[model samples]
Target: MLKTMHRPFHVSPWHLTLACGLFKLLLAAAAFALPLSQVDDLPRLVGLLLLAGGFSELLLSWTGRHSWVGRITFGSGALTVVLGALFIGGPWKGLYPLGPFVTVWFLLRALLSIDVAFQSRLTPMANWIWLLLRGFVDLALGLLLLAGAPLAMLAIVVFGEVREFVTLFSATLAVSFAIAGGGLVAIALTQRHYHRSDPFMIAS
Candidate 1:
């Protein structure tokens, strides 16, 4: 009975994957829920998404904190939470403040994704190639955002509207979130299936 109870307490990589997937889905929903026309809401939307992600990571880290990865995740979560709060409370307005901020965020996550995809090659993680592809997509999205920032500013100077720029960022985020969320969920399910079939085949 004690061993049976203890078994459930053991944390696995799939748990982290699932949590991240769910968080990303939440981001997608939030991004879609906010009308892109209300450009003022962009920063707030990003803040909420970051807060959700930070809390998810923090909770998962608490469960798996004996490992080095967990410690790193905890630190990241704390920093993310801080940043999220700042974004929410700050007096930022328009693309001038948000474009560069989100661009940097996407680029950092892209690098992390690519690194993790490579690391997973040593493990039996499912759809690792998809992960690699997602990383590339993220990288591309980040680059696009970076390039679009100046163009967006120019649009404001010429056309007096930044709707195209806003739409581009919003659409990119929604699509990226959906793709990453779906892939991570699939990978988690595959890992779960493999674990059931061979209890000792994969390490937690």
Candidate 2:
């Protein structure tokens, strides 16, 4: 007689969804709290954040063996880090505008996310919706930054309190990154759990 074994219950998709939702909400709230005048710095801040995020993501992807996420995430992170480094390291070139670069990055990220959504198993419709929304936000923010309208208005409203604006902006960005990083780590842990499961059982 063959023996059957039971697998341990792992974190469900719903849990991941909730965690991602909370992380996004925190990021949104942080953005809202940023002073209007500091908006111009968004591009630089985003570049720095991307650099850090990309490195972390690469580490996670390389260490985990779940499906396409590891490879895709690793590739995406490496690209982001390289591009971000170039943008920040290079001298200011009018043609290489932060807005356009950010826009392209977001679009690419969104398209890549389609793979993430379908990998391993089919992602829920709601997850696809979330990815689309994130893409939209990235596109909109990039456009806004390029147009220079919001930043101008913010500067006028704040009357040029440059130091305070910079400080607040930096703080908000730090918080956003913290939340995002934490969420990614959590999801990675969950994936590791699943990957480590026994090959004989579905939960494994």
Candidate 3:
């Protein structure tokens, strides 16, 4: 089992930042590729994904913590799950824009990942590179979301004419949920691997 501590291998914050950025980029790509219409539907999908990813992190935290790095990872993962659940529950009526919220979430995750990467002391060079790429992608996506608000609105208006567009939008949302759910499941499996090194721990 991982024991929580104040320090581990003397990893850096930039690594964690990179990891966080990469995760965000992956999420943005997954979301952007969908045929989603309104931003409201995004939270449900994102929340589900977070729930899965957090579960994984929780497991990793339990197993890898012989140091401060473990503590941070577990804490962050727990927080993510909690926040994700709140988002999934749909607290208010259109309280937040799905697009912006998702974009911000990804950006934050990317930052967190960078921190993780630096602190963990695990290296392959590729991991760091991946994280950097992810961060840049997430940042770009966030900027696009911010800049494309009017354009998104315009798309909504343009698609208001045909039922096919609405149908496609609904299908897109359904696919998003599936993909997010799958991602969560994958994360959970990863956590299980870290926890017991058992291939079967991921059956859920």
Per-candidate clash tally: 0, 0, 21
Worst 10-residue lDDT window for candidate 3 reads 195-204
Judged by lDDT against the true structure, how good is candidate 3? 0.48
Top candidate when judged by lDDT against the true structure: 1
Candidate-wise lDDT, in order: 0.66, 0.48, 0.48
Q: Taking the tens digit of each residue's C-alpha lDDT, what string does model 2 give over 1-204? A: 544333212223434434543554454455444454344555555556557666655654554335445466667678779766865676643212443565466556656655454442332121334334444444444454456535644774667434454444335344434444444444435444555421222321
- Comparison by TM-score, 2 against 3, better one: 2
Q: Roughly what TM-score does model 2 have, to 2 decimal places? A: 0.50
Query: Looking at candidate 1, what is the lDDT of residue 20?
Result: 81
Candidate 2 residue runs with Cα over 4 Å from true position:
1-45, 65-67, 93-96, 122-204
**Candidate order (lDDT):** 1, 3, 2
Which candidate number has the best TM-score?
A: 1
Ranking by TM-score: 1, 2, 3
Model with the higher lDDT, candidate 1 or 2: 1
Cα lDDT of model 3 by residue, 80-135, tens digit: 68767876886633323454565565457556556755543342221334334444
TM-score of each: 0.76, 0.50, 0.49
Candidate 1: C-alpha RMSD after superposition: 5.8
